[model samples]
Target chain A: SCYLIPNKMVPGDSNKECTDLKGNKHPLNSRWQTENCDECDCLEKEISCCSLVAIPVGYDKDNCQKIFKQEDCKYIVVEKKDPNKTCDVSQWI
Target chain B: SCYLIPNKMVPGDSNKECTDLKGNKHPLNSRWQTENCDECDCLEKEISCCSLVAIPVGYDKDNCQKIFKQEDCKYIVVEKKDPNKTCDVSQWI
Candidate 1:
């Protein structure tokens, strides 16, 4: 079985604190949340993960960059959480 | 910064070998394949990691299972890899 880890950040004190001039507080700490829980700060970078089986692996933890490609390596299955994307939950089973 | 690892599997020898009558060969090593490289095998367990910022956290590698919930924890936003889903590549920013 396989699943996802939606990495996201949240404000300390539950956003109770005030924000800076840019309307952004000192965002801190990142934890694993519930199912598809995407209600926090965006990832610190732009990242994508394609089905490794379909594409070549591009992983750089130093840069925190991961890219996933299509099976034939012709196209990139940009994993942007789109309805037509290829992130089938059935794969988890 | 954050990124994704498309966990997949591929045939040991690039799927060149044949399979049993059940169409199942002896699945071996699990390596990090291409972008969203979903070819070789699954993650062995059912795991889910939500935006801890928006929801609670649940991580159990022993059971190989993870679950993510909604902000209010009322609904279960199943991470099925759908376009309508909330996975934004920009989050990696």
Candidate 2:
């Protein structure tokens, strides 16, 4: 799976980069982009980099709390597909 | 070494969480109060979260460009202490 996160656009190119699940790419430094990110559905820097840990919306308010409660758990940014809060965060790199 | 990032305060306890550079901590759920973050030096949410990448200020404008040229490069966020535009990005969860 390839996840691309758009950047906040510092001063240069407002481009998006995606790589294999292994985090490796062909051209190496992310200069050679496959698709014209501009063609993507999202807008500008709004679609930049993927959130390091995509926090689920209703995570604590629903599911996790029932199982973990105030036990305090390590933060894990895993993809959530339950019917709870259904956080839809499609991140790019 | 622990690099804790203060978050953009969403409406709860304004605290900071620091983990080992290896990305692990003792009491996970991050509720334990190791230290009152207020005791630290920085300001409010400004210290909340750490940048996923502490982009070196002089990164492309100096070093890497000399070696990799305009061919494009992979984005690797590393702690920079160079003479050039050194970027100090202390990130957190």
All candidates' lDDT scores? 0.28, 0.28
Error of 1 at B55 (Å): 17
Top candidate when judged by TM-score against the true structure? 2
Interface RMSD of each: 14.1, 15.7
lDDT of 1 by residue, B1-93 (tens): 122324333645243232321233333333322122122332232111122222212432343322322233221233344424432221110
Query: What DockQ, between 0 and 1, does each candidate earn?
Result: 0.14, 0.04
Model 2 has an lDDT value of: 0.28
True contacts kept of each: 0.32, 0.00
Shift in Å, residue B76, candidate 2 = 7.5
Minimum summed lDDT over a 10-residue window in model 2 chain A is located at A65-74
Q: Candidate 1 iRMS, in Å?
A: 14.1
Chain B alone, candidate 2, TM-score of 0.18
TM-score for each of the candidates: 0.16, 0.18
For A5-62, candidate 1 gives per-residue lDDT tens digits of: 2434275524323222123443333322211221232234211112223222343223
